[model samples]
Target: MALQLIPLPPALWTSLPGRSSVRTVADVIGSTQPWRPISLTPDLTLNTLLSLLPPAAILVGIASIAREDRMRLLSVILVGGGVSVVIGLVQITSRDLYFFRITNPGYPVGVFANRNHQAALVACMLPMLGVFAGLRQGARAGAKLQAAFAAVAAIALLPFVLANGSRAGLGLAIAGLAAGLILYAGHQGAWSSLTRSRAWRLSAGAAALAGVVLVGAAALYSRNDAITRISSATTAEDQRFQFIPQMTHMTADFFPVGSGFGSFDSVFRSYEPSEALLRTYFNHAHNDALELAIEAGAFGFIVLTVLLGWWATRAAHYWRDMSRDSSARRFGRLGSVVIGILFVASLVDYPLRTPLLGCIFFVAACWMHLEPTGRTQKTD
Candidate 1:
């Protein structure tokens, strides 16, 4: 679907009001496109194609994997937090990395351009690791190993997620945990192993470790910008909320049709209100729904609607399965809920825009679909 739709936005843009068929730098290949004018030139068409390929590639790679290899795939996911923790430690202390905080050097950003994005990845990783620890209790040794892995990941990653100072990240982390608890504990006694004495002891130790790490992180990054941002977020000064109604009007002005593909930053200039006339250049709509609608017009909105609908169906089916099944299948089903967290996060910021995140999103979707739906078939 992405392979098809990603390239079409430019053509649709050319057909919009005041659009043209101008040629661009990226139009080096075959030029069968509709929205030829305005900003939807063959160049953006090429950009779209390039943008969607990585996700498609990830899907193809994931499809080649077998369902019984859940341990391997899941272990990789858990290890992501560990790797991030190491990188984040370096970025915070050395004040290096491309997205390193110059304004406030004490924050952990890892490989991401923004701390919130880092926090989002960490937030999503925790519950998944926890879920693995809960579900991988089929054997005694594996259970012990998984438990230790979960504890270490939590101790290493949770403080960064919590104290990294992303308001949305913190909220999403809590929400993700709630979603995981719901899906994971749906079946009676499904998480009995997680409630054992060893689990309690590990949790205690992880909690103490996380506390120490969190305090150290805060000390290192002495500024509390997150609190101020939250306050502003509640007020009218928040850029995200400010972008909403303006974007809504912009979408309406363009009507059922929108400005053009990749035209948001270019087009936002005309709609920029007097108050929004700041030095900070407004690039994204800050809201994916609004950005999609404004750029792709009604077509983008339609795509979002269909995706949400399909997501709902998958989630419903997965929820039903989680209610009765305690197999790896149910664990795969957790992807649906994790995506739900991603969706909610999407409303506030474009997590899916990041290439790595986009790949993760598709991989999870593919994993969810591969899992067998019935109680009889345990694996995909």
Candidate 2:
């Protein structure tokens, strides 16, 4: 008998209007800056307006879900943290040392003046990529093919991420992948099985061989004086250690209700020592938890604790339920990877502060919270 495949229903994408003339008109009008008498030139661009849609859509979707899931409280906490970060970003505006110009080139730092914020946003989304990959694994064959297409699209976009030159983001991506692998091993019921299966084992061996070849190539490249010199030309002094202590001290001074959301630059300027080991202005504390505590105060800390607690509870619950359901197991694994990425990334960068990353995290969390409908099939 020939096999027939069922197509997945297009929910969100189908609900949106096609990119027709109406959208173009709306984009133009939205970008126009109007004056009562004398018209000033419009500063807004189409891309800016388009960028706003994701956050607006996420906020609306989250609000709708909050009404029933009892997740509203956590959402409020996230919003508070977000607001605080924005406020701090706003307060530290300056010409020579603008909060927006500190990070790597080409990164958008809405309220943040640092590239790390942009990198953080990218890092947060990396784990979501893993989640989507895992979800696709449980889908029907046709759906799985679509998912593979999406994965290719994601990988294609990776070069942009690499261009940001965020060491923290690189670390987060590696860690998230490792976490995903560990979770997969646990879920599959055997660590050795990952390398024992004929198909998987051959693939793994080939990958190992390719990695060795790549390392050899890199070694050859490093041996070339020109390549070594070019690589060393852009090295920045490690000033994090010196700056971190000052940031720590500043955090201590504003322990309860941080200097107010987005107040880091202002506070850092006031408290920063004259000895000045670091040449650049510190926009974020470089520690997400501390930054949250400093910006949102005690309330923010409490909010963070609650959100983390809820996430932990949900993860544990799903992890337990996944023992029987492979699909749920995949979701659980992806969720674990995301949580791990967030925890590790928080230590070095603040991706949660960027709206793009923040919305992605929020959406992924919502997806993770959803209950699966499929029945478990016994593997034995």
Candidate 3:
């Protein structure tokens, strides 16, 4: 049956200047007036909003100490993730529904509006979730569970990442894995007494050699016709290089107070024209270093650098103190692995922009920095 539309009240219609011409409520909402005053809400300011998030997340993570609390936190994240996946599916199924072409052709976007962002969100969440699941069980049990989840997430995510065809995401994921492994080994004290033992030295040497050989083999394998086509299709080197000059130009023009947080894309396009082969609109500078430098300038960069340095120092301190406690060691290991992945991921992608992933990483870093003395204090 066809539904009948309800008519608006005469008083409501009379209140609007052009109500007679408006066909629907959307038309009323769409109209803009020059005389309207701007609202200065706390949420409207980027810095203010960013400030509120970390503390809140830390509090929540701190509160999640009991098994039930931990489960609850995990449930929330998973539900959010599931919702994101459904949104991604809808965006793909109803291509014509969204105005932005980028949101469609649904890559594993999860709940994110952007596929790359979605991939980054998943990458950050999955590792931590896997680690938590692992740590909840015995060492062997945890390792098995983590490995299974990691494998499944990786497999499920790989095709979606491929569908998005983001070279940056692929590169970041590989880098993240490498970083995770290094941190994992460090937390395990796998290299602590290296100089004292010939076995350790030999093992480290062999691992390094194997890594080099594996990389070389992969490079050679990727040069095949099928691989070459795929590689060429996904490659972003040319586009990335093109933006370096543009970034430099934009940075110089807006040296001190950046064009503003959400103003980079507009400013960049105005600064440089798109190359014929690369006519895509770029919202970010592709490099986090460059993007931050451009958006926040030197001051913001210094603050970020100092924060990272402090976090790293804390991580090191806690790591060193993990010698006595087995639980602390496990926590340090998992936390370091997660942080390493995020640090590496940030070098190429803008996962830091997403609140969920960013909050998790920030809190995890803080958690890892806590020095565990003899007794295990209950941390919620």
Candidate 4:
């Protein structure tokens, strides 16, 4: 899908609005490269291609593995998320602890360059932790131990997610937690027993209350900025919403065929509204859907709609009559839910643009397509 435009004529590539004097001498020299006319900006288009490889590798590589190995790989992803949460927490205290140079300095970015990306990744992992604990009881050592660890980890991680300060992240985290609980109960075949027992009901209430209190305490004790940011009024009307009209105009200018992939930053400048201009620039459309519309044009929209329809059809099939025996289907359900979360997050921010989150998104899709092998599969 990404390679579809490579064979198109160079003259078809959208031209830049004008050269900015602010561009450095190197920028001017680099603009004259032989491949410059290939796309709106062939350099950025190449970077986009490079950015896509890791996620593609993850999707294909994992699908080729045995079912048991795939389950183990999912467990590793759960562990990696936990480690990222811990790193994010440490980063809150020590500004120098981040792995990326361009990350949200003095903020909880974890292994990502953006806190929202980290938040979205952590949020997606929350439900997977519960799902894995519930369904991953193969003939392995310490299966019970694994379940217990997942439960404790989920509880401990909840407070951090609440304190992460992303509105989208916080909302998704709560929703994922609820979905995880439902998936867990359904898998354990304990829904009837859980509902009949008043103790279980009371325990759940208490846990919920404790979580709220913990989030409050964490914010108050640390004098954290999370609460403030979360409660603060957003300027979406001034920026994101305002860009919509101009973005639509830009998309219409290119109509059926887009300016080209990775062309938004260059093409958008031509259509940027005077009211929207400021000291900063929009490297992305912020809304991945709209950006795809601008860069890939109407064809992108049609492709996305078809893909969405396919996802919905598969989800309906996998989600119908879920049972403990149907572990592959259950795993697929989890993947479907995670994909939904990433899709929602993309509406307001470019979570899927980042490599880590992008890889997670594709890996989750791969999980959705998995089928039971009945121990007949070959090892990768």
Best by lDDT: 4
Candidate 3 on 1-380: residue-level lDDT in tens? Answer: 00001233444333433223322444568753222111111122345345557757666766656533433444465557656655665655665334355563534465555656665655455444444444433357666776566546544543444444455555444444344343334434454544535534544564464345334444644322322434575335556566677788766655554434544665566667645224567767767767666655665578779967876776666545432334454455555655666666676566666666776665555456444545533222
Give me candidate 1's TM-score against the actual structure: 0.77
lDDT of each: 0.64, 0.49, 0.51, 0.70
Candidate ordering by lDDT (highest first): 4, 1, 3, 2
State the TM-score for model 3.
0.61
How do the residues 1-380 of candidate 2 rate in per-residue lDDT, one tens digit apiece?
00001121334212222212323554577753211110001122223234557767886776685433423233343344345334434433432333453443333333455545544544444444434444333337974774575356344334333443456654454454344343433444444333335535643554454334333444544222222433564423444445677777765655553444555665677667787626667666767787777655566689889978888887776655433545444554455556656666777666665665666566556646656546664221
For candidate 4, lDDT tens digit of each residue in 1-380? 35533644323332332223322343667763222342456667778878898998987888788876766667788878878888888988776688876667877778877777887887788779878776545446676777788788877766676557676677677667766776665566544344335535644664475446545655655543556665675667447677888888877766666666787888788788787688878778878888888777777899889978978987876665443235676678888889988988898789988887888888788778876444321111
lDDT of 1 by residue, 22-102 (tens): 433335556655333333333553565578889888777877877656436666766665686688888667867545333
Q: State each candidate's clash count.
A: 6, 15, 6, 0
Highest TM-score scorer: 4
State the local distance difference test value for candidate 4. Answer: 0.70
Pairwise lDDT winner, candidates 1 and 4: 4
Task: State the local distance difference test value for candidate 3.
Answer: 0.51
RMSD of candidate 1 to the true fold? 7.1
Ranking by TM-score: 4, 1, 3, 2
